[model samples]
Target: MKVDFRYLGRSEVREIAGGQALSFAPNLARSKVFFDAEIVHPLRFREAICALHDVVVGDLKFKKKDKGAYEAWKRDQAQKQEQVRQTLLDQARMRELAAVVKEPLPKNLKGDFQRMHRLYWDARNKWALELSRNDPELFRHLVPCDPVVTVAPDMVFFECFAKDESSYGFLGVDRGAFRTEAGAGLGTTNVDYSLALYEHFQTLRSYRPTRLLVDPSGFEVNIQGRTDYREEKIDLPASWLRGFGQLQAAMGLPSRRFELSVDVVYSILAFLKRHREKAGPRSLRFQLQPGKPPTVVLEPWGIPIVSHGRAYEGEKAEEIKVWGRRRLAPLARILPLAERFEVMLFGSGLPSVWTARMGEMRMVLALSGWTANDWTRGSNLDQFFADLQADPAAVDKLAGHLEQVRMARLTTLAEQTNVPRSVLMGSLHELARRGQLVYDFSVDAVRWRSILPVALSESMLGPEPAELVAGRRLAADPSTTVEREVMMARGARLVVANVGQSACEAVIDPDGSLTRAKCGCSFFYKNKLRAGPCRHLIALRSVARRSVVATTDRSDLTVHLMSGTYAELRAEADKRTVATGYVIEHAWRLAREAIQRTASLADPTQAAGVYRTPAKIPQSLSLPRALVEEIQREAARLDVSVSVVVEAAWSVAADQIRKSSSLLN
Candidate 1:
């Protein structure tokens, strides 16, 4: 039957196991096994507890003593119960349970409740299988076994039968036991415990545990919005959890992989073998002997000894903290989604013991955690390089984000590729000049703000047009439009002679050198290359058309030079050159001369002083009142400033009259 799986926390486990005082059922009987129409993993906890009860299990009883202590405990328990009741009452007041109980599990289905205990183990085993089979780079030596036993938050045991497989069949007297005619190899450490457990099961005639999965589905699960229940909440072995976290963190790098080739597996095994040699008893480091088979022997390091002194035939093995189990568990939930990958094995930060399976091959791998975050966080040089080569769009997006996040400087894009940062910087400069990408020193990388070419969003798709980018929109009376003004003020500046709204002229400073030049065009911005003027130019052309239509034609506005007028025009040209920093080039001078011959009159002085001035007469103030009155009366006769009246009224009046004549006349 299909049932949504969930992990059962300690509370639910305790409740179903019979709240502290409940005793195991008496006279428990063992039942014969039979294959069902549908075969599924049975809840092992119930079977184990029932088995213990059936065996008369040494009559389990509470060991806690001290009457006063018990009394205090009872009082605390009562207070806790009251608190729980109050909490439930509060929740009820909130009226949120209507949604919860609306589609609740069937009542009195205790078997379903018992199923939750299996979820944690199931997830772990399933995850292991997935990695072993799919992730050749991550789990090269992981092997599928006949029986997998799981005890939540602590142990997971997998067994493979040797010698006699029939004795280890699901049923009969030998039930689930491998009858090895030869004793288990001496010096085998944890393998002995597994073997012993297997042998004990045979004595009890119990069925083989094909795979022990702590199914969490049978629990009273209240978790909402969780599609993948195992990752939502899981209780895994502490060491395994740590390994999972490291794996997750490491797998984020898309380049990381557990190489599956036979040669790679053998090399990994060789690495592990060398590491195990010089490692002290229960210590985690090994020394590497150079020049011979690339030997790796352990040296004294920070590796810890977790479980020790339990080995078969006087051989001892310590439970090495392979990976940071605590840190890795959470990461395992997300590692598969990472963009890159790097394979690591036998490192100081890695798990002490790990078996990877690559197809038919199985071996151990080794690594040093000295430079681990690179492999773990998707910043691995190899991964970055590969991404740079294969998928530029994704790389650009990632780079842009990293730059935005201010990690671009820290990003070793150059190291990933042979390309130099100088070359990249030049390209970036060109792009920035073209207004394709903007660089902020406060930021780490160039930010991609889609300017110039309008982004086609859903809203834009439906709408006529939008003023989203930085530019001026031309009005119906285009003569008054400020497109040219806006471009001059906001766009990248061009060093040119005779720069005007129409027919702007400029020469490239370094001939044929396109590096520094930029065009304010949609194509230039979008493509990040210096191309000819695009849509912006077309738009400007439209604006120019309107200006031409609204303004007076300049065809007859010039004056031809004749004899004495030539000397005056020469003087005027000299003065214009000094004022504007631009001497007329040969062609421009010839064109100007031609235009002057065609024009009958010179261009007016652009309506001098268009700005309005104050109409009232001005007066200068003095500390003395008598001096101020004299100055005011003097200003009244000329209707001018006191300073103007005192300094030189005639000259000031002549200048004012010339300005007015220049303006209105």
Candidate 2:
């Protein structure tokens, strides 16, 4: 089969890297070549294959910059919460608080309730004290310091380090136990089922034995001929490790109990009964009206409700009590104020149960949505497995249009193409990473096909013409023209300081114009500007270039973090202007300059044989005054050239200090 290649624009080209480019290139021996004067075209089949390769390679293209930013944000949020904690500590009457109440009451509570506002704030913080204060969403649940713990199936525990008794540290577990079994195939168990019940005495001394959630279907207790034991036990899956730990942590506290009204409690039981009789998994979404003439609406996530009124109160109350006692006993102490709660059960699989604690009441939630395979229509092949499925031809055409408009999304393409949804999705993803196709989120399926750039079938059947190849090669070389030169200047600087092997240096003239540049990484030189530069280029340019600049004695060069234990320095850096290795080097150089001034004054020969007179080291540390004044006139310039004046003054002052001190001595 013959394969052709399509050229991408600057923005579209940037998404892919070198590996994808090579993958998209034709295998001249077996495949036929294709060429176009302005734009090259290849067969859709080969394009699809090349696109797939591109997608795979691109997926691995980790964006370190984005990752670093996300980590920094997490750190910043933690610090901000600490600040809030400190402010709260300054307030008096910190003790005897239940929960902090927020404004905009449940559209009901009367006048006297306003006094409890401060109490709400204290309770919210109390709940957060047990959990890590780093998470704000969880922290909100703490009313003034009252710990609000969320109990579920797979819970584990962690002890808090701080030990101030009144400081609101780890008190004790109130609800369920956290368990880990010792058997194979445990990893396949559902996350919620793996919870262990926590048994807390009035004291913190003795704990009880906990049972892990096991598959009811897998419960095989056969009678051996004689006195025989069971073969093996099962364990929880590795995937549930995090959920298990969190669930256990919730148990390490005194339980905050609430109750659902008798009517509301009865309604929950009726819904569960109907779901038990139903075929597949069933869900009920309900809204609770707290005050006068209380009413609850039982809404399902998908299936329509046949009857909304109360049922099973007289007839099924006993059965409900039995099941509720077995499953709801742990939560029995706190069921009175359950305003709006949801419960979900799986016929044969793992069941997840949860209750969200709002103010006095809690709303329980369950995972009710169907699995991916259930939604997939294998024969239809056109619609996607998401909430909405569209026509296949429409999806492919949409994919084609996204390619023309230079958007990226094979999943969306599959939805549009109506081809086997999975195949189109996989293929579209391939094209996007290879930088051959693009996508836009704005358009519908019909409009998507309209946007793609047109490629004729005939244009993709042969070798690329010599003229086009030569032009492309020329475009890659930045030294060829002013436009290319400017583009390389910007890209070179961007990659110079990245954590990569390639390093490029740009020379700025006195007028602040980029005069000349060179990059050893070879990316910019090779005429490619996609997927940023490799890590090697970043290291060479950033680490190596900064090293060179440090030696240059430039006044603007700052010291920064090169390498060290983060914990040892993180606290100090927060207080004293934290920066990278480059900034740290700059600070050191400044100090060294001060030392040099003292040294020169102490030397007889350097001091011109005069005891108090200081010799000068002439250095033009800043640009000329005219250049500075010119930049000052431009509002768009980020940096003004006034730095020269500051440098000159600092140099003169250093000499003056040396002379005065020498005279005094």
Candidate 2 per-residue C-alpha lDDT over 1-665 given as tens digits, one digit per residue, 9 for 90 to 100: 11121111110111122111111111111112221111111121122222212211111111245588889999988799588677677553344232344334565464446447646845643554544335432332221111111111222111111011101111111112221333212111111110011111111111222221122212233334322111211121111121221222122111212223444545455555455433422323322222222233333323323223333122111100001111222232334433433332221122223343323222232211111111011011111011122344644564565535433344354444456653443444323222223221111111121111223132222242232244334434433222111111111211123222333444332212222335565544552211122223222322333242222332322112212222323333333322222222222234334423442323312332222222222222222234333323321232323222223223334344333322111
Report how far residue 39 has shifted in candidate 2, in Å: 80
Model 1 residue 369 lDDT score: 31
Candidate 1: which stretches are off by over 4 Å?
1-665
Give the per-residue lDDT digits (tens) of candidate 1, residues 1-665.
01111222211111122111111111001111111011122232223322222211111112356699889988988798589788988988778767767787878677565566567667666786567556632332232121212111111112221111100101111112212112111110111112233233322222422322133232234546543233221121122212212322222222211222233223333444455434433223322222212112223434322121111221222222222121111112112222222223333333222233211111222221322221112111111011112233433544455334422342564554344543443333333322234322211233332222222222322221122111124222234232221111111112321112332322111111111223344443553211122223323333433342223221111112233323432443344322110111111222333222322111111232122233333221111234335435644644644433222322222234323312111
lDDT of 1 at 313: 24
Q: Please list the C-alpha lDDT of all candidates, in the order they appear.
A: 0.27, 0.26
List where candidate 2 sits over 4 angstroms from the true fold: 1-236, 242-262, 274-281, 288-295, 299-665
Q: What is the lDDT of candidate 2?
A: 0.26
For candidate 2, give the lDDT of residue 533. 25
What is the number of backbone collisions in each predicted candidate, taken in the order shown? 58, 100
- For every candidate in turn, the CA RMSD to the true structure comes to 30.1, 33.1
The window of 10 residues in a row where model 1 has the poorest summed lDDT is: 164-173
